[model samples]
Target: MNLLLLEDGDFTAADQVRLSGRRLAHMQEIQQVAVGDSLRVGRINGLMGHGEVTALTSSHAELSVQLSTPPPAKLPLTLLLAMPRPKMFRRILQHCATLGVPEIILLNSYRVEKSFWQTPFLQPAVVRENLLLGLEQARDTVLPKVRIEKRFKPFVEDQLPGLINNQLALVAHPGDYPACPRGIDQPLTLAIGPEGGWIPYEVDKLIEAGMQPVQLGERILRVETAVTALLARLY
Candidate 1:
């Protein structure tokens, strides 16, 4: 962890925090700092700063913190992702968070397996935990908001049009479509598909909802790789 991410429960005072659990174990193994060592820290959804380790124990540690700096700006991007395989889903969550995606929608696509929804990683607390891992990796304080859409058609017909009203909506697919646009200063809603990609009918629905289909290249890439590539190329 690049930063010690503090939640409200960690605070004993306005400027003091107690740490244990994963963070404490991390500090012991990875940081290996002694009393009086200063570590970078950020309050969740608050500020970035440094904390002085004032006390230490096998089970816990205490830090005197001062928060003044702001976290990095988030990308003006909302990712609509077809639920990936259980294992890769976890990595994608962290990847997006670290890359500064402010919002995400775990969407259903024709190729997406129904069983993918049963993954424990989608649980609210677990979801938050993975996102926090990303934030800590990026030294960011704000957690990205995540939404799930189990029904594809309803989401596209009833909601996506309105979402695209003020954004550049693009669906990433491999085809003869336009290349993914780059570095434009605009809000974006980017839809990415599952393992085999969106079915033809599904692509039509997104097009009708206002997304212009775009491509990376001929070589097929994994969902996580595609997401990272698309986001990096876009902005």
Candidate 2:
């Protein structure tokens, strides 16, 4: 894991969490961490800090931590994604976390198959696993929040506004708008459509809801590639 993430109660002592429970091998193998080495650590939803490895063994390890500050501010973007199929869903979750979007909402689109939502990848544990892997790769400890919206109009009309206040909003479509802006440092709410893209009715609804329609390019892109490409361009 990048920065060892622990909840307030996860720590056994002042700074140590019981690694054997979830991440013993990660420490022992991937990191090859040694006693006396200081590692980056953070309490979930809390401060970032340093932990000194106090002890290490085959089964467990101990750390003495001192936290004084939080990790870097998360990317000020919210992703509204039409649920992709199960396989792509896994990769997208990790990509979202890795790119540092703090919130992700997976919604149903007209083209989205009803059966896709039944996939095991939607299970909370599976989603969290992918997010954690992303955090580990990014060397950050904060977890992004994920929300599912099985309905379309009710969510877009009733709920999206509050989350989008004062944010530059864009919807990724293949046609009918200027190029997606580059180097967008402002907070953004980016909506990416399904494989077949948002149907005309859905696009019009989103546009009426204050989303600025933007095209990635003439060539259609898959949901996974489009998401990463859009985020990279915005960054």
- Residue-level lDDT of model 1, residues 1-235, one tens digit each, is 9989999999999999999999999998988989999999999999999999999999899999999999999998889999999999999999999999999999988788889999999999999999999999999999999999999999999999999985799999999999888887889999999999999999999999999999998999999999999998988
Model 1 alpha-carbon drift over 4 Å, by segment: none
**What C-alpha lDDT, on a 0 to 100 scale, does residue 31 get in candidate 1?**
86
**Alpha carbon lDDT of each predicted model:** 0.94, 0.86
Residue 80 shift from truth in candidate 2, angstroms: 0.7
Q: Residue 23 CA error for candidate 2 (Å)?
A: 1.8
Any idea what lDDT model 2 has?
0.86
TM-score between candidate 1 and the true structure: 0.98
How far is 89's C-alpha from truth in model 2 (Å)? 1.4
Q: Per-candidate TM vs. native?
A: 0.98, 0.91
What's model 1's overall lDDT?
0.94
User: Number of the top candidate by lDDT?
Assistant: 1
Candidate 2 lDDT over 135-201, as tens digits, reads 7677666889999999999998988877778579999898879999999889999999999999999
